[model samples]
Target: MPILKDFRYHAPVGVDEALALLHKSKKPLLLGGGTFVLNTLKKTAAYPTDVIGLRKIASLHGIRDAAKEVTIGSMTTLAEVASSPVVGEHFASLAGAAACVATTPLRHMATIGGNVASRFFWVDLPSVLMALGAKVAWAGDKAKKTLSVEDFLSLTGPEARGIVTEVLLPKSGLTGVYFRHTQTMEVDLPLVAMAFAARRQAGGVKDVRCIVNTTLSRPVRLTGVASYFETKKVTEWKADEAADVLRRDLEQGKLDDYRLHCLCADLESLIDKFKKA
Candidate 1:
């Protein structure tokens, strides 16, 4: 069995206390449910000297719905988000993505904050949140701030170190779909994942956003393909044309041909469903 290296554990009850602990520690790592951090420390040689648990912070534990937006606390578990009626009704794709993460047990333990903060490419939430145009609110010793999900995903090192407080989803009722291609149905990391959102205007797609995450390091928005789709009539859109646009934008040779083909086919199917709706 893998063992976690020696570390001092601190549980802070408030955001200010947590931030103070984080700033004072020599090598502090934030803990939210401890699914990702604990597992990594168990299996990997790298470890932090201090582990600061955020579970004691009461503010980071609930979902709040506003007139124009919905805010989900970072410490809220994947299971909570998956089963939330508000989330399901407003952002079905995000709910679906949350439900599909790992298994029942892991979902119960994996917090949304930990999942987003880790920024693991294989994870499902990041891509769907990005497609939905969500914003992330974070706090640190310096100050609290917010960033677009796209911008948050692109950050690295110190820029991404703050305590993720909540994820804000816009109330705009856009249709979205989340697709994950795994080798088996029995809970495994996806070979390719895609999340797409589009608004229909005058029977044509408008405000389109498509995010793709493969075996690569991070998910990226396929702006070129989204642009192409925006120009075509929803009813007139063809699968082959969509595939060709994705193929060109993705630079065909970088990914395994078969996997890319499957992704393209799935994306076409997703678009077809949107067209029919």
Candidate 2:
């Protein structure tokens, strides 16, 4: 571990108080569960003069299940997410993704907000969130707004001057499945991943969303692969044909053969799941 430089840390009890502190502090960094920021602070020279910790904020910590969607507070930890029966019942892909993060203790310390806000391309949540068609409720200097996970990730430095308040997951009667691959143990950083989701329509499935996290850049949506699966019945889906289209979908991604092989194998497993479903 690198040496963590000296910095003044403030714990605010509410979002408004935290935002006020943010407005006044120069080069301030917001701390969520501290799994990412604390690690980052040890290595980065662009240190914050003030570290505003959001842990004390009560409003930022619960899972609310509504009739239309599930609202997860930004400060909700991965362990909380993984254990929430509502999350597991409604958003199985996200629940599975959360459960697969780091280890038990680390999961307890890592917030969903930190996971999404870090935008560390290689991390696990973004692709699964995108596959689930999730959105973030953001509070910023200018105004409050809701943006899709894809749009939220696309924001640049200046444009990202805000905090994510909540992650909104709509209930769409969709079945979601996630598959992750790592070079070594299951706890290792994933080399690649795939998130598959779709709604069962009459005689077939529709709204197919196939997402691949390359762990290189932004996660790619496998539109070609999704299109191929969209029109076909679950029984008609074949692994070899799906693999061929997946290769075309990933033509520009320039992934190494190993990553591609893992993804193909996962795709075959996904097809098997569909058949079983």
Candidate 3:
């Protein structure tokens, strides 16, 4: 049985209060939906002295749709993101990733903010968010920063620690699609995944973004694959040809044969979907 050690728990109703509590504690852990943090606490040997619960903060809740963009609060759960009409309409890939996270009860308790902040490479949303060109609105003791999701994901060590206040996704009119391959249907966690987004022009596409989550490293941008597909008419896309480009894009990556095969299969599916679109 896992045992939680004695710790101070602080539920702050405001961001300012939460920050104060965070900076004051000797070892502080931020609690969002409590899906990740609570579970980590049960097994972590390096226990935090204080757990700052952000659930009560009024500012960190809800999904808001505006003329220019959609804002999802940090505390918003995966279940909420998956079910949101605005998210479903504007960012289908994000909604799909959220829906694919875990079992029903886990989705209800796991948050988008926690998922992103956890920085676990196997987690579903980051690659999709990267493909959608989302920005993370973050607050820390030093500054309030809004970083591109790609930039945020590249942060390492202490640079990654902060309060993710919200995710800002612009209404770019880009269609996004996500494909994740799990080791088994029983496990919702992704073993490898791909997120593709592009703006469909009259006969071609523009601003194409292809991001792949190897679950072995940071989500890799398939630049060659994106470049190959860019400005080409949908009719010109050949799955086999695109697979060759994908192979070149991942040549530098240390992927095993099975995962590589899976990515190639995903590429074919993506091309076929777009061709039929």
Candidate 4:
């Protein structure tokens, strides 16, 4: 492992101060829980000259539960998110994702900001958040902005420089399930992951959002499958039909036969579980 080079650390007390530091530094990296940042620095030759820690910022710490929405501070630890009653009650899929991340010690140190910002396909939170229709709030040197999770994941270059302040999730009538499949019992990284969210209507499913990750470069919604489900009765959902829709929608060249099999099985299992609920 490469040793992290000497770097100046700045623990800013406010968002403005943090942005100022980030803009002024030759190579500045925002520090969330330091789980991803520190680990990356130790493994790669690329290292930032300055680290702007967000720990001192008071606004980026707790969860806010409103009548129609829930806002999670970017600096909030995964462990806190997993254990929060508000999150468990409103977004159980998110809670389950948080609880299954790495292990207990890493969860205590990993923040949602870093996890989403890292944009690693294997990371659990991004898929669940995207499926839940979450939005990201960012703070930068010039101004603050809010973007949907899908848009945020596509950012690059200057567009990705801002510091994430919070994650906003609208409270909805939809129910969701998040499933993670690892290669083995000891492996933390998932081989395949799926998130399913939908509102059970009188005659069928509504507002269906089915996301698949780990087997792709980024999480992608199975729009074809979702549309198929939206038109069919919940009791009539079939595993083979769901599998055929997804196979037709996705690029077969990107996934081999085994992965395709796993994806189909997981999606079928998720749909069965969702219907039973």
In angstroms, the error of model 4 at 130 is 1.0
**Tens-digit lDDT track for model 1 on 1-277?**
7665689999989988888888888888899988878767877655788889999899999899999999999999999999999999999999999998888999999999988888877777888898998999988456788988768878777766679999999988788889888868875877788899988788787889998878576887787789988998877787888888888878843878767887788778886797677
Whole-model lDDT per candidate: 0.86, 0.91, 0.90, 0.87
Candidate 3: TM-score?
A: 0.97
- Residue-level lDDT tens digits of model 2 in 100-207: 998888999999999999999889999998999999998878788999999999988667877889999999978999999888984578889999899988657899
Candidate 3, residue 146: the lDDT equals 96
Pairs with backbone N, CA or C atoms under 3 Å apart (clashes), candidate 4:
none
TM-score of each: 0.94, 0.97, 0.97, 0.95
Local accuracy of candidate 4 as per-residue lDDT tens digits, 110-218: 9999889888877888888988999999875567999898888898887788899999999996787888887789888777788888887786879999888764578
lDDT of 4 at 71: 98
Pick by lDDT: which candidate is best?
A: 2
TM-score ranking, best first: 3, 2, 4, 1
Q: Which parts of model 3 have CA positions greater than 4 angstroms off?
A: none
Q: TM-score of model 2 relative to the true fold?
A: 0.97
The residue ranges of model 1 lying beyond 4 angstroms of the native Cα positions read none
TM-score winner, 2 or 4? 2
